[model samples]
Target: MTYETILLAKENGVATITLNRPPMNPLNSQLFKELGHAVDEIAEDNSIKVLIITGSGSKAFAAGADVSEMAYLSPVEVYNFNMGSRKTFDKIENLGKPVIAAIAGITFGGGCELALACDFRFAAENVKIAFPETGLGIIPGGGGTVRLPRLIGVGRAKELIYGGEMIDAVTAEKLGIVTKVVAVDVLMEEAQNYAAKLAVRPSVAMKMAKESIQAGVNLDSSSALNYENQCFITAFASEDAKEGLGAFLEKRKPNYTGK
Candidate 1:
């Protein structure tokens, strides 16, 4: 299907999905539905090994869901809105392929939630981001209350979510909200550089590692180890593993087929 709100490009086993809504780039319900479908397209394409998400303009990654749209929602409409967000967020979090969020400018509320859903995040030096849900007489229902706390800590997450204030990129990196930061001029380049490198890695191993880490986070030590062992076995069973080891012994680069 043709997408008016986003752009998708794939090359060298990397797919870049750019949110194209202009001005403040608000995340409306339609955008959420399109995002879910786009992410699924990227995930199902076996030739794509890495996915990078970013904004089309330099002004805002996404300022949040269009607040104007939320002005007159009933309880059922609110439920539907949050459910769409959760569905799209799950698309990111559960993707077998690694997804990197490239935040260049303002990212708040649902946008923050979207970035958090990705496996990795790279932001510009002075980029601004926050939750700001509490200030609107509601709470972060798009997994911000849950995911933010997991990334940073309960204390810091609570403080940010409670105060409804923005944080700079450096602070976000320190708080674990972002993995790295660069200048605004080179933010997308830097993020794409990292993503390109990841694209060449063993896709099977990356998928296994992601699963292991995700499972480990919500389980006890013993249960986590069991999950890791299962992932380890799965990784070893892949064609990439055999090629990687044999190529290593032969002093050559291993080619993976994502088998």
Candidate 2:
């Protein structure tokens, strides 16, 4: 598909989606529409085992949602826009395959929320992340309010959201917001390598594990454990599991076909 706001490239079972509105890659309605289409394309491709999302240039992962697009909208229009973005981010977060956010430069507001939707994140050492929505007389309408607290605890999420303060990569790493932080030049390389590693794993098992973990997080302990056990058995029944077991006993690496 032709994409104006983003670029999609696939190689070796890994698909990378680059936000392409140069400079800061501000999120606008068109960008969100293209992103939804991209995700749908990825979802239909069986060979795509993992996905990576990042923005163009080293200046920013994304500065924030396009403020100009929001400067003068009716309340209904704002609600519609928020819902569209929320749905896109939710699709990313709950995708059967793993998703990684390769972040660099400034990541604020909706940008930060977008990264939070990914299963993992790798950021450049100079990355700055924050939710500055409150200062704009708004709030994170893109699932940030729910996901941030779940990721970094309620107190910390509240503090950051309420103050609209930005934190550097090191602090973000320390707070568990990013999977890892690397030098600016190696940010993409690191994230791609990680995605490649995940892509080679037993696909069915990996997807099951991801789903189990995500669902478990929101359920009661007893219910979560029961659900996890069911997911485990489902994975155990896959052909990949047989291959994994056979290869283990043969003292050789498993060649999973994603069966």
The prediction achieving the highest TM-score against the true structure is 2
lDDT of 2 at 2: 83
Local distance difference test, candidate 1: 0.91
**Model 2 regions more than 4 Å off:** none
Candidate 2 TM-score versus the reference: 0.98
Clashes of each: 0, 0
The candidate scoring highest on lDDT is 2
Model 1 lDDT per residue over 1-259, tens place:
8888888899989999889888778888888988899999988899999999998777888998888888799999978988999999988998998999998789999899999999999998868998898998989888999999998899999999999989999888888899998999998889889988999899999999999998899999999999999999999999999999999999998998888
TM-scores for the candidates: 0.97, 0.98
Worst ten-residue run, lDDT, model 2? 78-87
Local distance difference test, each candidate: 0.91, 0.93
Candidate 1: the clashing residue pairs are none
lDDT of 2 by residue, 1-259 (tens): 6899999999999999999998999999888888988998998899999999999999999999999998898999988888889889988988899999999999999999999999998999889998999998999989889999999999999999999989999999989999899999999899999998999999999999999999999999999999999999999999999999999999999999988
